[model samples]
Target chain A: MSEVYAARRERLRERCAASGSATALVSRPANVRYLAGAAPRGAVLLLGRGTDLMVCAGPLGAHPDDDRPDEALRIQTLPGAADGRGDPAVAAADLAVADGAESLAVEEHHLTVARHRAIRSVTPRLRLTDLGGAVEQLRVIKDEEEISCLRIGAEIADQALSELLESILVGRTERHLALELERRLVDHGADGPAFATSVGTGPNSGRRGHRPTDRRVEEGDFLSVCLGATYRGYRCEIGRTFVIGTSPADWQIELYDLVFAAQRAGREALIPGAEYRDVDRAARQVLDSAGYGHGLSPLTGHGVGLEIDEDPQLAPAAMGKLDTCVPVTVEPGVHLPGRGGVRIDDTLVVRPEADGGPELLTITTKELLAL
Target chain B: MSEVYAARRERLRERCAASGSATALVSRPANVRYLAGAAPRGAVLLLGRGTDLMVCAGPLGAHPDDDRPDEALRIQTLPGAADGRGDPAVAAADLAVADGAESLAVEEHHLTVARHRAIRSVTPRLRLTDLGGAVEQLRVIKDEEEISCLRIGAEIADQALSELLESILVGRTERHLALELERRLVDHGADGPAFATSVGTGPNSGRRGHRPTDRRVEEGDFLSVCLGATYRGYRCEIGRTFVIGTSPADWQIELYDLVFAAQRAGREALIPGAEYRDVDRAARQVLDSAGYGHGLSPLTGHGVGLEIDEDPQLAPAAMGKLDTCVPVTVEPGVHLPGRGGVRIDDTLVVRPEADGGPELLTITTKELLAL
Candidate 1:
């Protein structure tokens, strides 16, 4: 694991050196974790031009039970960070200057303008440059270990969703169900829910990123839930819609089938070399032709890994192409104003045709179920 | 409530006008919520030089059940935010330019360098100026309505903590305890947790911001838990320490008593004109006299409002004086290297001596209980 993290840091160093920066700072939590194996809250990774270091705001190994920062890197702690006055990024910049680095690259998208100015003031002689999304691009293709973590996370999410299906859901509010699913995820060995669990009932169903409300599930209503689990820091998502009662209304069944088909098309299009927008189109065109395109969500799905949402976005106007081992989600849905809606989503890894195509990580049955 | 939000926005506008800016953009979610009533996720508030607007990425009234964006303010939605493609800040900047504003003030501490640059590029002729902590400073003093919400949030948090104390704890893990506490917070009608619940046992006990783990309660363990509830967006925090078994060891009792005294001293120092550092010193000196000050957290207490941690931080180096109606948490703790430790935290509001001194929002008993 340490070697893997070291290799990642080495690659980042090469990118920085090529861009005329011998050293780089990673303040984004996910980016720091990707190169440092683990990052304590408020920790930053200062890479190259010195001993690779993970500078933490608090004590080293704050969560020692699960924290396993790369053994190959040294750790430094700011004296008063836990009190909220210390900033690891500024301290890391000072360290960069002490290491004799002439220039340092940083993630301009992550650091606030105030922090950037402070860093500049702390190390006025050290030239600062934008590292852009270099680390994010490097993370697009996952190693086998990373994929295994995502696979486990997906399995946990599937177990949690399936268990919710077997239980009595009617009369229970969306907020309660969301909380139950989160507890189940943890019981199944997940670090936590990858994101806030969304359980929408009736009119609220099928809305993307819908925050769970107190509206209780009722008979003849559509219930949509989107949840994920984080296993070993890898996140995977699965969303499904179901009928509240035994028999679904005609409109509910129709909407569910349409969303299911669209989601399937998006998943099936997750082949290596496929353009991101093409995959989005595969799912989007299904809904567009069906006349439900007016309020369709922006993207069919998005890449999921260390962060629930990542690069290789399967959206219209997206420029990137998918690659093998890149895990992404395929979610598509539509909602009627006063009625309900349906959303079917799954996590899958892009794979070559020789490897039997995209590997589905979340195997929860998407068939519209009447519970 | 709408009038309250309108007045807050007017005050911010006056500040911006005095700073040579005709308009201001608030991107920080809490600050936006403070000025715009209820801001949607990824929403920004554009104030002055035109009609006050809350520019959101999603649909209008996404969470109509509880969302109450100021009725006096206009709501605008970016067409592609739910698809994860829209940036409310950039759109707000464009609106500022369209409003004929020659200069705009933005929260530089919250906006990323990339985003700040994007806003600059979008409206090059519109001079961008730093709003700094103008909004945060405005938020330090609470109105009667704001204090009422915080009072309710503190009550909910206290109920949750007391309920947990009555449950069987010998075999429970810290993670389970944390989850149960959060569930209770929601059950009691909280919007959600103010922050991540922290439950630490044995060697992990009393560490500020300790992430829960799977360690089960042991007979002689010192168990510490810190949790908060969010009621209508007002956040309040409470923390307590207990011995897992029927009787505590001498060291556990001593440490618990010391922390309790420290917390009490800090809480008692919350006067209308008290210097922030004086409150911190009132707590720090107790721990320092007992030789436990070496690793004490930087700030003994800090102001709380829409955001859990806010301005007027009660720290040694914090520059400010406490004003009446400013709610803050006085949390003091000690983390022993190998054994365990103790922390006692409570939320209180500063008041004049004529008004019965400080108002204790969290009335949970600070006694060290043996569960």
Candidate 2:
């Protein structure tokens, strides 16, 4: 694990050196964790001329549940412990300047304007440059260990969803169902829900990011649930839409079939070199030709890893192509105003046709189940 | 309720006008919610020259659990549906400049350097000024309506804790306990958990922000739990320490008593006009004099409102005077290296001595109970 983190840092160092920066400062927690084995809250990773240090805001004492900092890197916790005073990013910049590093690269997108100004104030002579999404791009293709974590996370999500289906859920409220699913996810050894568990029922079903509510599951309403689990630091998402009662209405069946087919098309388009926009179009064109394009969400799918939403966005305006090991979600949905709607989502890793095509992480039945 | 949001916006307008800016842009979600009644994710509130518009990346769709936006205010979903392309703050600034406003005040601390540069690039003639923590200062002394929400949230938290106490807890993991508490919080009408629930057992106990893990309870172990509930957007927190066995060891009792005394002293110091450092010292000095100061947490308490952790931080270095109606959490804990320790926390509102001193929002029992 330590070697893996060190190798990741070395790769980031190469990117920084290519950009004329001798030091790289990672302040984003996920980025820091990606480069450093583990990042304590408020920890910043400074890869400088002297030594790599993970600067933290609080005491370095261990908490039972905390991910221990990699022993290969030095750990530094600041004094005074006041908020906004002892920023780790500034500490990193100062350390780099003291170590005689001429140029430092920082994630300008992650650090706030005030923090950026503070870093400049601390190291007046050190040249500051943007690292941009270099760390994010480096994280796009997962190593085997990273993929294993995502795989476990997806399995945990599946188990939680499966258990929810076996229970009597007709009279339960969306909030209760969501909470129960989250509890089951943890019971199945997940770190926690990858994001807030969303259970949308009735008129609220199929809406993207729809929060759970008190509305009870009715006999003829659409029931859509989107949930995920975090294993280690990796996250995977899965969404499914079902109908209430023993039989689905004609509209419900059509909407469910359309979304399921669209989501399947999006997942199938996940080739090693496919353009991101092409995958989005594969999913979106199906909905568009079906006259459900105007109110569609901006993107059909997105990359999921340490954060529920990451790079390699499958959107019409998105640039870049899917890499072989890139894991992304292919979620497509259509919501009809007061009548509810349908959404089908799955997490899959892009693979070449020679390697048996896209590898599906979340294996849950997407058939229109009238429960 | 709409009138309250309108009045809050009016106050901000007055401040901007006095500072020579005709309009203000609020980008922080909590700040937006403070002035616009409810904040949608990625929503920005613009106090235009002639009118106020709440700009969002998408339509003002309802969340399943969270509160809906106050319908009185005008809303504008951006022309393009893509999130990366639309900048509500910049759009608000452009609207102000187009409406013949010469200057715009924006939350500099909240806005990123890139976003600031982009706004400047688009509206070259418009003078941009910093609105540093002005809205936060305005939020310090909450109104009676806000207090009522906190009070209800506190009740929900109290109910959740009480229910947990009645359940069997000899062998449950910390993660399961935390999840159960959160489920109960929702069962009692919380919008959600105020923050991630913290449950620590044995060696993990008494740590601030301890992420719950798979540590099962054992006899003679110290168990510390910190939890809260958010009602309507107002958040209140409460933490308590307990002994797992029938009777606590002599050391556990002594530690719990010392921490309780320190917490009580801190609560007594929360009078209107009390110095923030003095309140922290009132809590700190007790633990310091008792020879348990080396591993104390950085702060004693902090203000809680629309956000769980907000302004008016009560720390040794914090410079501010507490005012009436300011809600804060005084959480003081001692974490021993090898053995677990104790932490006691509560949410209280600062009030005048004549008004019966500090009003406790979270009325959970602080007694050292041996479960």
Candidate 3:
């Protein structure tokens, strides 16, 4: 495990060196964790110096869940700086310059302008460069160990959703249902919900990323739920829409079937060599032809990893090809303004045809059930 | 209500004009909400232009909890930009430059380097100046209406904590307790927990800002819980420690009393015109004299409002003085490593001697109860 982190840091160092930077400071929490194996909040990893240092503001206490840094790397605790209060990025930059690094690359997309300016002021002689999305690109493809975490997270999400289905959901507010799902996710061994558990019902149904509200579940209304779990820092999403009564209305059934078909098409298009935009188009065209494309979500789906949303976005303007072992969500939904709507989503990993088509991690049935 | 937001924006405009900035863009979500009365995610409020516009990425959906923008302010929804996806800061900058604003101010401390660069590229001729926490300064002395929201939020938090005290707590894990508290917060009319609820048990107890873990409660263990609720965009925090068994150990009782005294001192120091450092000192001196100051937390407490952690931090190096109506938490804790510890926190509003030294919002008792 330690070697894995060391190798990741080596790869990042190679990338930085190729870009003419002698040192790279990873301030983004996820990026720091990817390279250092553990990212205590406000901890930063400075690479390419004689010894890769994980600069933290204070001692990592009895935090069982905090990722442990690679044992081989040196850890520097800045006691003068208050625990969890000072900016570790600025401290890391000062250390990098003091360690004789001439050029340092930082994530411009993550660091605020004020912090970046502070870094420049502290190291007037050191040249600063942008390390734009380089680490994010590296995180796109996952190893089997990473995939197993995702698989476990998906299973937890599935168990939670299944339990919600078995219980009484009628007359429950969207907020309560969402909270229950989150609690169930934790009960089933997830760190927490990968993101806010979204439970949209009645007029709120089928909306992409709709925040749970106080609206109650009612008969003949569409009830859509989207939730995910975080296991060992990996995240996976699953969304399903169900009718609230004994039988669905004609419009509800039609909307559910249309979304299911779009989601299936999107899932089927997840081949290793497929373009991201093409996969998005495969699902989006189904809804477009059905005349519900005008207010469609910006993206059909998005990549998921340590972060709930990452790269390789499945959108019309996305520029990239799907790679093997890249986990992504293929969610498509259509919501009519005053009426209800439908959404079906699943997390799957892109795989070669020789092994299998896209390997579905979130296997919760998409069948529109009348609860 | 609309006039209140308009008046706030006018005050900001005056501040920016004094600083030689003809126009100002508020990209920080809390600041945007403060000035515009609503901050749809990814929205920005541009002041000093003929019409102060709340530029949002898309139409505000049927989100009842979302703050309604001041009626006097015109809302410009860019339908082309996906909901909550586009950078309204860049759009606002483009608008400002096109409207012939020669100079514009922005919250450099909040904007990322990439975003600041994007704004510069889009408006090359516009002189970008640092807003420099001006809005935050304005927010420091909150109005009575804002204080009322905090008061309600504190009441909700107190209710949630009281309910938890009645439940059995001999064997529950910290994570479950934290989640239950959050569920209860929503049940009591909170939009949500202001921040992640912290429930540290036994050795993990009394740690400031400790993330909840899976450690279960045991007899004689110290249990510390910190939680808050967000009501109408205002947030408040309250923390307390209790003994798990019917009787506490001698050491536990002493630690609890010492922490209680310290917390009381800090709370009592929250009068108007009190230096922030003096307030912190009032708390620190109590624990320091008892030989437990070596590993004390950085700050005694901090302000809470639209955001859980805000300005006027009560730390040794802080430079501000408390003003009337400024609500802040005076939390003091001592963690003894392998053994447990105690923390007492309360949110109170500073007041003058004529009106009452300070107003306590959270009414949760400070008595160290042995459950």
The worst-scoring run of ten residues by lDDT in candidate 3 chain A lies at: A79-88
Q: After superposition, how far is residue B195 of candidate 1 from its true place, in Å?
A: 0.6
User: DockQ-based ranking, best first?
Assistant: 1, 3, 2
lDDT over C-alpha atoms for residue A332 of model 3: 95
**Interface RMSD (C-alpha) of each candidate?**
1.7, 1.9, 2.1
| lDDT for each residue of candidate 2 in B296-365, tens digit (9 for 90 to 100) | 8778999999999998888888998999999999999988877888999999999888889999988888
Q: Model 1 captures what fraction of native contacts?
A: 0.86
Q: Tens digit of lDDT per residue, candidate 2, span A233-336?
A: 89999999988898888888888889888998898899988999999999999999999998898999999999999998899999999899999999999988
Q: Tens digits of per-residue lDDT for model 1 on A135-225?
A: 9999999999999999999999999999999999889999999999999999889999999999999999988888888899999889999
- Residues forming the 10-long window of minimal summed lDDT in candidate 3 chain B: B78-87
TM-score of chain A of 1: 0.97
DockQ of each: 0.74, 0.65, 0.68
Task: List where candidate 3 sits over 4 angstroms from the true fold.
Answer: A83-86, B83-86
Give the C-alpha lDDT of model 3. 0.90
Of candidate 2 chain A, the 10-residue stretch with the lowest lDDT total is: A58-67
Best by DockQ: 1
Instruction: Judge candidate 3 at residue A240 and give its lDDT.
Output: 93
Which portions of model 2 show Cα errors greater than 4 Å? B62-66
Badly placed stretches (over 4 Å) of model 1 are: A84-86, B81-86
